[model samples]
Target: MRAATGLWRWRHNPLRRTTDLAEAWIAFAAAALLCVVVPLTGWAAGSSAHGSLQRAVRTQQEQRVPTTARVVRQADGPGSGPRTADTAGEERLRRSVVARWTAPDGSVRTGTVTTSRRQSAPGDTFPLWTDRSGHPVTPPMRAGTARAHALIAGLMAAMLTGLLVEIVRRLAVRRLVLTRYARLDRAWAATGPDWGRTGTGS
Candidate 1:
């Protein structure tokens, strides 16, 4: 905040180093950049995710259908179905049961389907999704889920932007400090040892 207000520009101050002014300016620049870059990064990431997810939702809706199926028997879900990640990048496991359903062709088909219930009884009706081949598959993605994915992407992008900004700020400050120290070292090398020796002149 002090840097944002240009306090280091007060020329009357006797305690200021060139490095101090340089760091102050750098701080101001870093703050300004953070304000702009963070939001821009988030928007870009969110928009890209939104577009991709929206497309996925449309595709799934186009190629799939929601239907009801009767549980043929209690069964274990496939251990290897498609894996989807949440915002935290955790894999969500799907539960399932053996079920039978009538397809678009009016023929009865039997297959394993994802289910929400931990225990299901045979002949109990449950919701399921079917692909073009009438085989049970994952449900179609919804717009709400797509929006959630976009939000997560945006937040992650914003956090990464903040991290980058901090790293750059630290590097800038370190560079200025090193430069100041080098200048001091050079000045001392030229004058420190010869101060009292006096050989040349007083």
Candidate 2:
């Protein structure tokens, strides 16, 4: 109903110009494409993202192994404890510490790791993640995280699809407007100097 009302000029208007009908059709078609293509594009993007992230999660879980990191040295600053306000008995702790852990290949890997343990001393153990190459890395992607990423990708795809459709509509309208102006100019030029010679009907 709303679409019909919007295109009424092109549907049943006797006074509508050719340019008006063309513009109306272009707008209508663009609107339709935007409604359909945008969602499909969004779905494709989201599905691809979800699938890729899921694969990454699987690979990470399969190849990577979890192990404990042994603290080799305390991180920079005061006590390796949580930050505190009172300086009397309270001490600043560095959550991050230099630690070493055995890699999947039995090689030892050492790096700074952030932990929640307070005042942890040398040889203290902390949980950490490592990749197949034995390099320390962040945790693997979770299903919820993948879904969130897919949502963001879907929104971006939808926006880009709509933007492209609008550009096409704008270009079509601009061409029609320019063509109409040119025709009007040519008609004015043909009759501008011939009005006074009406007596010479030839």
Candidate 3:
């Protein structure tokens, strides 16, 4: 609204200079882009990210297999201390155990995997996820998680677009202001010799 007011005030005023109109137009253009382009960019980015992430989710579901592993013994090694960090919050609290399971190819596989059982002993069982080759892998991404990632990507893209627009607007305005100042200086210099005599009827 302020930009509109400035534009209207400068539209036909006798004192309006070229720089004044240009500055007003720049402000209006910037406002328009912020209102229209920013949201569109965000939506496009989010949609693209959603499609890619969903495809990955589907691929993981197809390639991974779930099976029950019989615990062979408690895992004791450098990497088997404790699951302090995991994608699934509850899994982070689980203890690592060496377990054996049959692969999709019917071959026996053994690996260290996390289990929720507190007093796990040999022959005890826990659910596990592995690839067809029998290597342990993280579970597939959930739909909700994919959506969350897409949303974050969209927000970041929108913020970056806004910042770039703002920077361009500021630079253009600064250039216009500098040009206006230079013109003023030239006009003043041209009239300097007669500035004092104008009031003396010379």
Candidate 4:
């Protein structure tokens, strides 16, 4: 009998409605699932994108041919080298190779190619390289590192998950508050009219 009474009271109680509780629980569960799945999806997408970019860059580099080129001049850094220190007044000599080639339009163009890795005179003959697209190629750009991709993926997933959780939580709290307010209104209406009447003196 006590259990039955308790159940009856709970059903009509403004503080503990089944519908409100269920909504809150569902919201919590949905948020939890999103937090787990968003990161995994972001990581997979980032990995695939990074791999595709790297492959494209590699293919472009491989098409260029290695040619004999002159070392025009070495780019200088902040610190002077041992040779520079020893030579008080000797100017560093730079050498490079120049070649002329006709384009598809039959226009002759001259370009200089330099290689610092080789020790050669200014007039040394070397093959200049042209890429598959017939354009002079430079070094390929470096792709994003694994660590950078991972960090990006993590940040993206976190933002998505946080947004989803906040939205669900807000909706759930709103529903709970509305339901409680409705119950309070109904309870107030059930009170007898005499409860609000002022006392009359005979």
Query: Which structure among the candidates has the greatest TM-score?
Result: 3
Q: What overall lDDT, based on C-alpha atoms, would model 1 receive against the true structure? A: 0.80
Which model scores highest in lDDT?
A: 3
Model 1 segments more than 4 A misplaced: 7-18, 76-96, 194-202
Ranked by lDDT, the better of candidates 1 and 4 is 1
| Local distance difference test values of all predictions, in order | 0.80, 0.78, 0.86, 0.54
**Model 3 off-target regions past 4 Å?**
78-94, 115-119, 199-202
How would you encode candidate 2's per-residue C-alpha lDDT over 1-202 as one tens digit per residue? 3444558845677877898888877877887888799999999999998899889888878876788889898777432222334322433332678888899889887776666687779988977777778776556668898889988999999999999999988998999999999998999899978867878985
User: Which lDDT tens digits does candidate 4 get at residues 1-202?
Assistant: 3334445556656887776555546565665556676666667766666676677767756666444433343333311212333232332333334544443344544555443324655444544455543444444435555446556766676677667767876787788778888877888787645465647532
- In the range 24-65, model 1's lDDT, one tens digit per residue, is 888888888788989999999999999999999999999998
**CA displacement after TM-score superposition, residue 133 of candidate 3 (Å):** 1.4
Better of 2 and 4 by TM-score: 2
Q: Give the candidate order by descending lDDT.
A: 3, 1, 2, 4
- lDDT score for residue 82 of model 3: 28
Candidate 4 clashes between residue pairs 3 or more apart in a chain or in different chains: 71-95
In candidate 4, position 131 carries an lDDT of: 55
- Single out the weakest 10-residue window by summed lDDT for candidate 4: 78-87
